[model samples]
Target: MRFLSRRLVMPNDLNFAGSLFGGRILEWIDEEAYIFASCQLGAKSLVTKHIGAISFETSAFQGDVVEFGLEVKRVGNSSLTITCVVRNKQTKQNICIADDIVFVYINPETRKPEPHGKTKAELDAEVLDI
Candidate 1:
């Protein structure tokens, strides 16, 4: 997976126990995935269809920075599957990992799934060709 975004845990982002909120972390993961899917597919109309098993390995306290990493796992005719991992920047420890996030391309007017016409191999080639 490619490291995509970083965020600093803050007091306002904490739960009652003073740890980073799981909901906030989920927001970060979804946002990062959306950005990646939009960029990779060259389209802005994307919808999160599913998120698979998410396992939290550790927790972060206020002031700890976290990095979200994502990679394209598969590309269907109209859907893109991404895997994600988040880690503490200071300790370099994995905080959470999730697989099976699926985002689908949509047509704004039709409000229906549309083909993205991309594959992991194609993306890899594009990177290598660069």
Candidate 2:
């Protein structure tokens, strides 16, 4: 997994009990995963097709820094599946995990799934280019 982004927990991000809100974390996950899929497929016209079971292992409090990490699990003809982990940046304690987040390349005009025309090998090579 490659850690991509970090966010500082703010007061507004907390739940009534004072921990980070589950919905807020999920929103961050979706945005992070979307960006990862877009880069891997080399296309911006993609839609989130599915997200597997989400496991919340721990809580995050205000003033805590959390990092989002993602790994490409599978590359298909028109879609990519990635896994995500969000953890405390300082202690490396897992806050949440999702096994699969699927994104499908689509035609913007038609809004339908379309081939991204890239392979797993190509994505790997692109990573090396960085």
| Alpha-carbon RMSD, candidate 2 | 1.0
lDDT of 2 at 121: 86
Task: Judge candidate 1 at residue 124 and give its lDDT.
Answer: 71
* Candidate 2 residue pairs in clash (backbone atoms < 3 Å): none
Model 1 lDDT tens row, 1-130: 6786899999999999999999998888889889988888889999999999999999999999999888888989999999999999988899988889999999999999988888889877765674
lDDT (Cα, tens digit) per residue for candidate 2, span 1-130: 7898999999999999999999999999999999988877768999999999899999999999999999888889898999999999999999999878999999999998988898888887787798
Off by over 4 Å in 1: none
Please estimate how well model 1 matches the true structure, expressed as its whole-model Cα lDDT: 0.90
- Candidate 2 residue-wise lDDT at 29: 95
* Candidate 2 local distance difference test against the native: 0.92
* lDDT over C-alpha atoms for residue 80 of model 2: 93
